[model samples]
Target: MNGHEQGNSRAAPSRLRIVVDTDMGVDDAAAVAWLLSQRERPVELAGVAAVWGNTGVDAAAVNVVALLRALGREQVPVVMGEAAPSSGPMSPIGSLVHGADGMWGRAAGTIATCPKDLVAFYRAVAAADTTLLALGPLTNLTRVAALAPDVLRRFARIVVLGGAWRHGSITPVSETNFWHDPEAADRVLAERLPIVLVTRDAHRAFALTHDDLAALATAGSPAARYLAAPMRAYAQVTGRFGEPLNFPDVVAAVLAVEPAAATVRRSALVRVVTGTHGLVRGQSVMGFADNERLAMIEGGAALARLVEQALAEPTLHLGRALAAILAREPDNAEVVLAVDAARVRRSFLCALTREART
Candidate 1:
């Protein structure tokens, strides 16, 4: 059922309005389709902004449109965002997991020719109580923060499907999203906006086996059908590595709509490694101690410069900012450290298979 048809009977006083910023990979498509299938719930898909990560900018937009059309959600607007990262060219590493087309070579639908103005669109959406669901690189959101910090602060919160605390998926110390654009990730974290970080530490607990795909195929909803091919393809690819499919984006989406699904959460200071150029680049330096150590190490030169500037000026603003950075006094983000895997999996399946209540 479409979003309008499913939630028509009841007055959803606490309906969540979400603007999804994605790169339209297989997992991203799964997340979007799952969100669309929540007909019985009070979640609204405000809009989708496609950025360059899992695919090219145009391809990402096309993929989102295709998924929406498959689920009878063509009414939702789709816009293209940044074509590449601010610091360098687009990375093709996502192709290994998502395939060359970003949707397991199954993306198909009419392309939307809407103008690509992510900042403007986001600004407009900010007028409402909206949560930004970021399922890809932080480039687009960082652009918004750079061009319009006031507008960026207007959103209720941002649910980021990135980062890794224990280990990384793409690299030893870096997650794919942050690895793709560490500069942008660093800038976003520095903004200290209300952010819910769904990292690898949490998503790794929610894995999807072949059995889940079989169940989804049997269920046969439009969302399920749309998800079947890509998920299966994803499983096949990861199977070679003796690993099950993990839906990081889907996990983040679930947490966004149902915050209670998260079993373990911690408020912490997070810093994306951007100053250094090595294996540690894009690493999510979490906690006060780690962040402080990282700053003292990789950022020693920058810190020295900051100290010099502060010493020269002795201004309250610079001194306070320096103190906050050095001490890591207040937590900036709420990190999702763990989730109820069984409950998340069950809820995901039910959303796909169960009929909307009248």
Candidate 2:
């Protein structure tokens, strides 16, 4: 049943309105799942703009549709975003870390995203004065800001799951998402918006232990089951390497949902290495003073349990209705319009890539 039809379990109008933009991977999928699981509980979980990181931007949106369906949260549509970075070397989707697809092998078949007009849809839903939870590269936000800087800057807050001052994701000094497109990161970071950065330290801080999954073996909820299989798969990998399953994006997600949970370790203007040269190429550094809040959470077992509980809550989301509509009505005007949009997006990406490098 669509979220619209079945109705959300928690409908408090006072809840905060939030949007999540992601790059689907095992971790990102895990984050998206956590976000939906909290739908209408404390936040509206408004729109999701699926952009690039672990997979192609559109590919992430396809997985988002399937995931939303799995959790039953179709009322909040997933809009496909920038296929490539606005201004840096694209990262190849390596390691089946999330599986061959973006999720637990559920992203194989063809999937359709919200009616073809991604730009319009993204603009329509990512309204001014709303909070934004960015869980991927800064590519999509850069593109949007390029279209309307004022609108982008108007966001009440922008919580990023990127950056690694204390560590790295791709290199010893660079985080994967920021490293993937440092130019875009530079542009987005230069904005006037109040930014909250969930550092890599937060990832290490808010992680899952083998015992956590052991406990989930009995939790009865779609979110728990959805997280269980893939998490177990993840645990198997980390177990062999003797590492914990960290949920950095969830830290950012929780910050978006509950701003009070975060402790801003540093508040400063940030800068990222944009020159295509060394180990510090994507490293994001901070100036001694500013409005951006670099966040970290230090809640031992409590934080872990918070994420576990979130996953255990069911989310109401949509059918593959968009797929069905496209299947039955292949000639729909939206499809035609979407083709044009793709060309525009491609042109923008190409131009930005060239200009940023120069």
Residue 293 of model 2, lDDT score: 21
Tell me which residue pairs clash in candidate 2: 72-316, 72-317, 73-316, 73-317, 74-317, 74-318
TM-score for every candidate vs. truth? 0.85, 0.72
Clashes of 1: 0
Per-residue lDDT tens digits for candidate 1, residues 194-241, read 999998889988887677778888787888887888888888888888
Cα error, residue 16 of model 2, in Å, equals 1.2
The 10-residue segment of model 1 with minimum total lDDT is 289-298
Alpha-carbon lDDT, every model: 0.83, 0.63
- Candidate 2 weakest ten by summed lDDT: 330-339
lDDT tens string, model 2, 1-358? 7887668565454667788888877677666666665532456777888887777766778777777777778677677788787655556743445555556566567476456455575567666657888888888888777777776665677888777767776788788778888898878776646677776655555565565565554455555565667667766765676666765666666666655455444555466788686788889765432112211111246445544655675451112322332233121000000012222222222221221110
